[model samples]
Target chain A: MGSKEITYQQIYEENYPKVMRLCMGYTVGNESLAKDLAQETFIKVWQNLEGFRNESGLSTWIYRICVNTCLAEIRRERKKDKNLQIDNLQVSDSVDNATEKEDMLVQLYKCINKLSSTNKAIILLELEGLPQLEISEIMGIKHEAIRTRIHRIKQQLTKCVHNE
Target chain B: MNNFEDLQNKWQNQTTISATEDGFQSLLKSVKFIEQKQRTGNIVLTITIVILVAFLLYVSGYKSATFMLGIGLMICSLVVRIAVELYSLKKLRTINFSKESNTFRSDLTSYYSFRKYTHYVVTPLAVGIYTVGFIILLPLFKATLSNGFYTYIQCSSVVFLMVFSVFLYKQAKSELLKLKQLQLED
Candidate 1:
């Protein structure tokens, strides 16, 4: 294999779980959809590998691509069918039985889905344990603004999850 | 789950889905396929545009006023259509997928709105002029060609226009739907 292919393979292996976790948060815990989004994000990364300028951390670049991909999917789904959101909220077909933890995860996702699309991206990044500054970078908001938004989102998710 | 800290802890503890070797291999193959597909599409579009321009130049030598007028209108319309398509493609390339969410959304909104304008106003105008141009040339074709060939030209033009109209309508509908999607609530 060429050096580029070897490097790309390493990057893909390292980041797949992170990308999948973020995608799951975006897809309302739909594992299949999350997988698809993650796959799409990696496809883009591979395509644009030649243009990677190293201006930002590699993770930051990958997360940005993943976020953009998820946002596009959300827009497409919003226009295509309203019911898909509800369908995604149901236990995914791939999961035969839902554990209590899985149920809570779904409940959390349901709450996250209630936020505005921008907020959804923000909290998903936050949930992935990205620094507030990094979230600000991915979101293109001021760090102060991201911090405040994260606080609000956290409280909102807590209330929504408790209600569920 | 109630406490934010506990939620974070659980999120961190969730088992990571390991990448399968087979999946990675397939992904590499698909990436190669996508690259080839995009390259092919660009080449085909470029070749089509070149052929259309060359055909227009060839017909310009006929020197009849009506022929020139008809061909001129057709070429102008084709130019407008091609310009819009090329501009759209350029705009899409300008959007940086690595940018922050809000900026990316703004860029996409700009791109979609441009498409919405093209679909609603520019495309119909171009198609109408092109159709009229073709019709204007029909009498010339009838005067110059065999009766059988003239009839064949007329029949094929009508079929082509019908098919093109349907394609345009579908494209406009899809663009409108995508524009609606971009209206994200704050």
Candidate 2:
């Protein structure tokens, strides 16, 4: 594949996992919804590829689209009273057979979904190892606010995961 | 109780879902479909507006008061509807997709509400003019067709306008409701 032709394919291949992971967090492990949202996000990226000015890094641009796409899907789900976040989730607290690590992983996602959408994007980016400055840039917020928000969101996630 | 550190560790370790080869192809096809669909809609609307403007120019010379009035109302309604759609499209085009989540949320809400206003007010006006605009052509239709055919044409035109208006109204309402729910949750 020529560079011109495979450019979009290359980006999709590289970012698909991270995009789906962000959607997974946003949708609270509603796997099908995550996939659907991921699909939509990539479609948008493909459509708008020509318009990208490189003002923001490609990853940041794609992440922003991912967040917006997930938020849009979540909103549509809410209108249908779809219980997309906490309720329909197959979140299991029982570690009876699964490892303790496995059980906590599910709980962590549950807690992540408990957060507001912006926080979900923030913490997901943080967990994915994006710098706070980059997260702030992608989120259109002050760097300081992102730092404070990350602290607060972590506290909230901690509480939710522990059922405190 | 998992602390923030523990949660972060688990989150990072969680499995990532990769798109299957077939899944990627399907997604690419969907992107093509969506682009085609959007382009089709825009082209049809543009063509309709162009045809209406051209026809209005052709009809303007006749100087019948009712025909002129009907033409005027239709041109007004078409312009408003197109302007609203253009404005919505412009807002969407300029959206900094990499901006703040809150900004995206608010902008989406704003677009839907503006569209709702246009659909709510302009659709009815468009329907009214559609009926009147067709009726204005009754004289021309009568010159070529029987009275029964003219009556048939008028009734069908009105019915089509009503159906079209209702479709627009329902679509706008559904869009607005989705945005409201999104903002409500935020």
Candidate 3:
């Protein structure tokens, strides 16, 4: 294989699950939409691979792309129906089919969806085990702000899941 | 009550869809499809401009000042519209997705505003100029053609104008609505 293809293969293998998880959070556990958004993120990654500079870690760049792709979907969805809600009720409706852990996971996504789009991205990356510094870098916010936001979002999300 | 650490443990252990070997191969194909789609759009617009210019040249449209003015306006409108689209495409490519979220959003906001300006102002002006140019050529068409053909041409042009206006209005409205949504985000 050529150098570019080999590089892309490595990047895809290392990052796909992480990207998918982040997308799942953004979509409120809607696996189908998460998969589509993850694939779309990779498609963009493939398109812009040549333009990638090594200014940041490759995974961090991938996270940025995945976040933006999810946010873009929100704009597209809004254009179709201005008042369309995310239908988090679907997750609850299917709760009987899920394990206890899966039910909590679903509840976690529901709470994540309640935050603003920016906050959803912030908390997802935080939950994914990224460093606050890296999350700040990906989000273009100060490290202190990211730290504080994550702390507050965690409390808010915990209460939300408890209520559920 | 589950603590954040317990929640984090559940998140870490969550089952993720495995990326298969075939997925990369299919992704490669999709990359080609996307490039082809973008190229096809530009190709169609470029070919239209070429055909219009060639027809104008073959007719020696510059022989009469009125004909030149009318055709010139029409061709100019087409050329400018294509240039704007190409420029927008280039600007979209320039957006660095790897940048921080706020910077990325800022870049997008600018792009959306540029598009809004194009839709609200540039598009209407271009369509208006095109319509006027078509109108300017009507008297010539009436004088040169047989009465039946002239009537047909008049009817067809009016119908075409109505359809074109409605199409443009819907397209611009949809685009502007999406851009508005993007700008509204935090």
Candidate 4:
């Protein structure tokens, strides 16, 4: 196989899992949707790989594409059926011994959903262990801006999670 | 453990979605779909450009020919753009986000595909075509291409596009952050 094919395979193997996980965060662990969006994201990355000017890290570019893809999906949904609403959204329930971890996940999503889209992106990327500079690039913002937003978002999430 | 850090740490401790074959398969399929669509679109666009270039060369001596060619390219580009947009709209229309579980995901996938077209495919192509049109018309319209006017226009446009793109990106990012905040609310 050519280097291009090899690189594409490598990208698929290395980034696909992380992209799906990221999609899961955005989709609130709706596994099917997460998988679909993750797949779409990789397809985009592959299609545009030649245009990856290297100005930003490949991972950052990938994240940017993923976040934009997710947001665009949300926007499109909003337009098509104005009355559409997320149903039976699994909010964090009362903590129990057996389901504490699951409950935390649910609550985390609930709190995340409360965030503005950009803040959601910031917090999610932060949670995913992306660096500040990389987050800024993916977010198309200054590093200081990302830092400030992260600080504010964390404080906001803290308040929300505690109150829950 | 009661502090914000503790809360974040706990949140972080929650397990991620496990990787699975189904997920990979979906991703691969979507990628193939997008690739096919992009290829088709590129082919159409290239053909349109070739036709326009031929027209321009053929009618080099006729002012009407230049005008006709310009108008033709503009119309073709606009039509192609509209077709692409309509295709996206149609794809999006099929998604029922209110349905259980995967609906939002499907909607999201469509949305991303639309954005991928707009950002990676459409925007850059539009810009390039506009640049070409500008260049093509400069000579035909009797505008001096050597007096640094072209340079100034190009420079100014690039600056404007960069600033506008960045501004738009920031606003979108901020909006995404706001959504995240809203989702977090109790």
Ranking by lDDT: 1, 3, 2, 4
Tens-digit lDDT track of model 1 for A62-92:
9999999898776655533223343333333
Q: Using alpha carbons, what is the TM-score of model 4?
A: 0.53
TM-score winner: 3
Task: Write model 4 residue lDDT over A1-164, tens digit each, in one string.
Answer: 56865687777777775676667667766666766677667766776777777776677777777876776554433332323222323323345642654555566777887676667777888887778888876766778978998998888887787689
Error of 3 at B133 (Å): 1.0
Residue B176 lDDT (model 4): 54
TM-score of chain B of 1: 0.82
lDDT of 3 by residue, A34-99 (tens): 778888999889888988988899989999999988876766553323332334322222345446
Which whole-number lDDT from 0 to 100 does residue B32 have in model 3? 78
Q: Report the lDDT tens digits of candidate 3 across residue range B1-186.
A: 688887777787777776889988887788779989988988987898789778977868357888878878887887788789789889988887767889888888888789888888888899899889888988888889999999998899889879988998887787687677667666
Q: Count the backbone clashes (under 3 Å) in each candidate.
A: 0, 1, 0, 31
Worst ten-residue run, lDDT, model 2 chain A?
A84-93
Runs in model 1 lying further than 4 Å from the true structure: A79-98, B13-16, B141-159
Q: State model 1's lDDT.
A: 0.81
Say which prediction, candidate 2 or candidate 3, comes out ahead on DockQ: 3
The TM-score obtained by model 1 is: 0.86
lDDT of 4 by residue, B26-91 (tens): 556666777789679779968977886686677666666556656555555655656666676667
What value does the lDDT take at residue A128 in candidate 4? 78
